[model samples]
Target chain A: MASLKDRIGVIKLNQKVAKDIYKMVLQFDDMPDDIKGGQFAHVKLNDKSHILRRPFCICDYDISAKTITLCYAVVGDGTKVLSSYEVGEKLQVMLPLGNGFTPDKNVKKVVLLGGGMGSAVLPAIPTSNPELEYYTYLGFANKEKVVLEEEMAKVSKQLTVATDDGSYGKKGFVTNILAEDMAKLKPDVVFCCGPEVMYKALKKALEPFDVPIIVSLEARMGCGIGACLVCNCKVKRAGEEETYVRVCVEGPVMKLSEVVL
Target chain B: MSNLKVNIAGVEFKNPIITASGTFGFGREYDRFYNIEELGGICTKGLTIKPKLGNPPPRIAESYGGMLNSVGLQNPGVDHYLQKDDLYLAKRDVVVIANVAGSTLDDYIAIAEKINGSKSDMVELNISCPNVKEGGMAFGVLPQSVERVTSAVKKACPNKPIITKLSPNVACIADNAKAAEAGGADAISLINTLSGMAVNYKTRKPILFNNNGGMSGPCVKPVALKMVWDCYNAVKIPIIGLGGITSYTDVLEFMICGARAVQVGTYNFNNPYGARDIAKDLATYVEENNMDINDLVGTLILNK
Candidate 1:
């Protein structure tokens, strides 16, 4: 269990990377050198109206520069406020929160699937484990929403992009493409992070493969620590009744089979 | 350091800043950010006779200057807490206050009996949880029920002091505080979250899974302060004030109004190190003012 800390991070960059999505790079003097793949940063906004801090997955971290990059969509009041922050401004954030993805050491082949803003967390996978053979599948609503292709490509052995509208890449759902490539890819493990709808579809699409799947779930959180119990997800344990686990603690990342989703 | 020590009932706290129940989970999670022993006391999450899974997804909704929570009392039962968390909490140099909730009188008694003479320094009777369907807010709304529940728990736990936590949703908050004191409660803590609800306009439905939730944060400070003041004047027993407490200034305000100690609730979520920082700031404030921390309690003057 990595210890969580509140650090005042200086925003080095805050700019739009895609439609309605902006990327922020923050520099912290005392951040942990290594943050897990699926871990997120709980960012506090300047506006007092929004009491709860917004949780965003860590897109990447630069240890040498002591910086962490976060990519988020301007969906709510918190993000809207965050988008307006300029460089040199101090942002308070709790870092390296929740249980991140655990890549199996014995597994040789890996598949990473991300959708929309979910693509933000995929880039860290290959960066953390450079030895593993990787395949990336990214899904977007349209071509305009697509992002992080060049960054993910630098790390993945094979990268595939899918859009709902046939504007860029394949014309269909990313899970459909995942289904087609499962046999050929024969990935030993699969990691996914996206919308709830995508997880529901991927749960069925990857059911036949018998490969272990890890997923990073997102929820509106009060305290990004385990205390508040606001961000809960149903998890079914072996030989026990279904129970709720805090997404901020037990996971943002969990085994597909363990989660009730 | 200006005599930060304060005694609640027979239990002694190093300072007047205790982490509120439900916000601090057995002192482990927040310990990662700061030392739990830095505070005066820690109130564990609302424990029950049986383990609770709590409400479904979307248990929280952010409101103006506050947030609503429908996380009903989610805990691994009193037995589990004693078995797993008691030893760990006991080893720490802080007072451990067990905050217990139940659906029925027997449920309260069962948990009280389990915690009696345990490692817990005190028992905080949480009869004001609004998220549960039965028992919680019911026992807290009326003065008679509040007295009944407080007396029952007081009888059950003979060794530990019982602090009845009163709800603010009632018609008269001071009457409930006096009721707890009349029922043999050792002390009183007031202004548990006020019952409220939030809606998503697009869906035209409540945001919380439980439909209604308890609202706590800076938004409830004035309401909490008044309740604490009213309760202080109503009862001779000490009052632990809470409701949207965020900083040392809020703590001072609560103390001056009549709270012997203040509990940091929703502010814990906003900043994990809030209690620690406030404690330090309070010490500095006391030193700068050239007064002991005790002198600040119940110092508010009524305007003629």
Candidate 2:
């Protein structure tokens, strides 16, 4: 493996575009070059106490602007420290850490589903796909927790939202809405990134439908590399009941059928 | 500046800071963050006669204040390490201590003999890995076996310093340290990991595939420090202390209680730059106190 620490350069902390979430973007001259959709970057907050790096999936890769956008929730100490960075301060980041999704030629129609912070990586991919028809499905706990609705709607050919509290869009879960639109959308492939329960529920719903499916899994990660096997999830292997693979290295993305879910 | 430098047998280390084997992984990954050469030394990943693929998935699990691991001593063999010509570490300047494990006494002897002729600064006999099915902690638990392996490696690698790493899984760490000393070991490193298990309440099964694993991290510091103190009082040989040392205070506790040098393990997983931060923080502590680092060693007074 290439130890390309140089791939990440000094990215100035732009500003706190959202509460508890800083909207820092990479500005390296060489960055945004060849940065494909669905990739991730390792962000390091300049703090002595929180030493390990944190990984974030790419929200938007602007090759022209030489920037990548990432919106993360400040759930722990690392992100809490990260939120302290101001517009001029610099931080070290390792970009494009994992393998991202590539739109298949035969699979023209795609549906993107995301929930909570999982909604971060959705806008960058299917919304930007020019050749294929793509629809975005999002789920949130309530209207107050809903995010990126306008941005997603701007890019997707059709947008559907579901809130558990029945506060916005449709009542009940996102998968329920997908079940209603399964016939008209006729998506060739389904891509999902969300909470474990959300993914687990979606997995069961999509099981009967025959199509290529890809999912991004989340786990507690120390190093955004394969060396430390801290970030692993159960994956089914041929002849074997189940095996754990690193979510950081083997994937953030896996085929619906290939993964045990 | 405080004298943080320490000596094992005749070999010298610039400071009491040493990176634990397996956790540091041959010193390749962490170098990406800081200059590894600044630390005292590095105990490489546990190497066997032949390369090991390690255990299956679910090798690590987190606990309240610590973590458990069943890495199963995965590493390329002794010959492979020698063949690399230290290419991965060419640019760095640090003492490279080779950690060796074997199924039998002969296995330890063979690996020790090979490391004696290699660039490794010292030979750390792995008599205490709880994750492995056999031949690791098994060799360290029984006093007779500890003596047997220590003596075997000492006899095979007379030129190199042989530090027998002790297992906390035993009934008494002090007795194990004494056995290693009597067996002719130059030094001893303690508390490999207390045997532990974390049950998934819903599944009602153990978290690790091995059913049990070695616990390391902040959770076990007190247990490790107590073991180090006990072993330090029991044996004349230098004690290399390790167990969930994540801060300057933890390092100081190890030193004051008679650890010649300290190793940072599980904390590496929590923080990639853990070693560097601890080194800096320890140095600052040493300077702020207006005392030498050696002054901290074995200063623990056992109440009569």
Candidate 3:
């Protein structure tokens, strides 16, 4: 019912922002104006050696410039290949994919949380939902691995950065700091994106707070749309049987309580 | 003037490009990308009598020049399809092919019977899926089982043509193709994904949760062409060749290797418009060359 096509995007800027993390700015001539936070872009490399397109979260976007920023970590060959490219190279990029984060009518004060590179999914939340108040907390292994803190800070009403070994920002986990802040601020909702282990930590840290927690998920994707069943996430809603929904389609975003994790 | 039409089991197709099963879903997901009627036909995902949830993620892994998928035949039951996608596809001008899979003869027969009266123009019997743990690839590896499953499904769904899909993981794919032909299949499709695994060196565990998956993409083209050529010389029925077909030239290669028509797989994920793009490209090539598209089928001249 939704007719869209894979678009050719020009790489405007590609630069390393942190340790092993690169922020790529892609300029689409016809970028979808409806792009939101937590949605992703499936980018195909110009090389033929890799068949699957690597998916990245829409870290940020500039509507007036028709450009979107993608933040990725060079963890594997696909991302490694992506980091090698420079400006002016054109790639097949399918943007604004998957369902993005949307705050409900009553949601006002929202706490934005990120762990390490998962902070890439945060900045766009404020860009799209600018009306809501955002209190952000970001955690990285150390300062070298930290990214998007400045972009996140500019938009966030208050920004807190943490490192496990205290290389920079506050020492210890961001989840613990968020729990302390949650007690004082009492935000209406908490939105997070991070490694699975961080989610385990956040759930425990925010247990005393009675706010709805939403999260963005990650999966090994094939078709960044729902057509291929490879990118599935297990979802178990209240009183419903455990079922799988495509993370690329049903979500990169879902209610934390409903997720099987 | 060039002709792009192809006839498989007496069913006429406007073009030689069909989107392969499993990769194309029910065609709705792609309808958002392009008009479904632009292609020759559409093959639905592998279906069963009952709904299947399929394997867990990470069910997919990227390899050199291709990708591995262990989707495990996830599909809504035939009943759900008949009530939903069947009606939707029947409304379109394109040919609808329902790919049915089962773990046993009874499972095959039941699903085939259910699809017989549906809107699908043909039934693709998926005996070669390597991901399922049960009766899937079991019936595809041997000539006898291939024949047995083909004939039983044919007996149940006698009204429409049956295309027995062959797997490349078998001992002899040509023999299996012959077995399918002899069992009264009107046509056949090959080769399903090759059985393979992608391992993470750091973890020493397979990337896929299922530990194995069927591999498809441009890298599998050579193997698929050889198998298609072997099956072309072995069987008389029409063959719908597919394995790593991406561009129009790839379609020509498969046709020259004895494919009556070609199906675009994995490439659909590379670009949602991949199937339509290939079809358009092939149509342009045929028109510019001024030759019938069917004239290239089985036309390969091997080196002596």
Top candidate by DockQ: 3
Q: Give the per-residue lDDT digits (tens) of candidate 3, residues A149-197.
A: 8898898889999999999999999999888877789898899999999
lDDT of each: 0.90, 0.78, 0.92
What's the TM for model 3?
0.99
Ranking by lDDT: 3, 1, 2
Residue-wise C-alpha lDDT for candidate 2, range B134-168, written one tens digit per residue: 79878999999999999989999988899999988
Highest lDDT scorer: 3
Docking class of 3: high
- lDDT comparing candidate 2 with the true structure: 0.78
Which model, 1 or 2, shows the larger TM-score? Answer: 1
Give the Å error, residue B21, model 3. Answer: 0.9
In model 3, the runs with Cα more than 4 Å from the true position are none
Scoring each candidate complex against the real one, what DockQ results? 0.77, 0.17, 0.86
When summed lDDT is taken over every stretch of 10 residues in candidate 2 chain A, the lowest stretch is A1-10
TM-score (C-alpha) between model 2 and the true structure: 0.74
**Residue B117 lDDT (model 3):** 89
Report the CAPRI category for model 2: incorrect
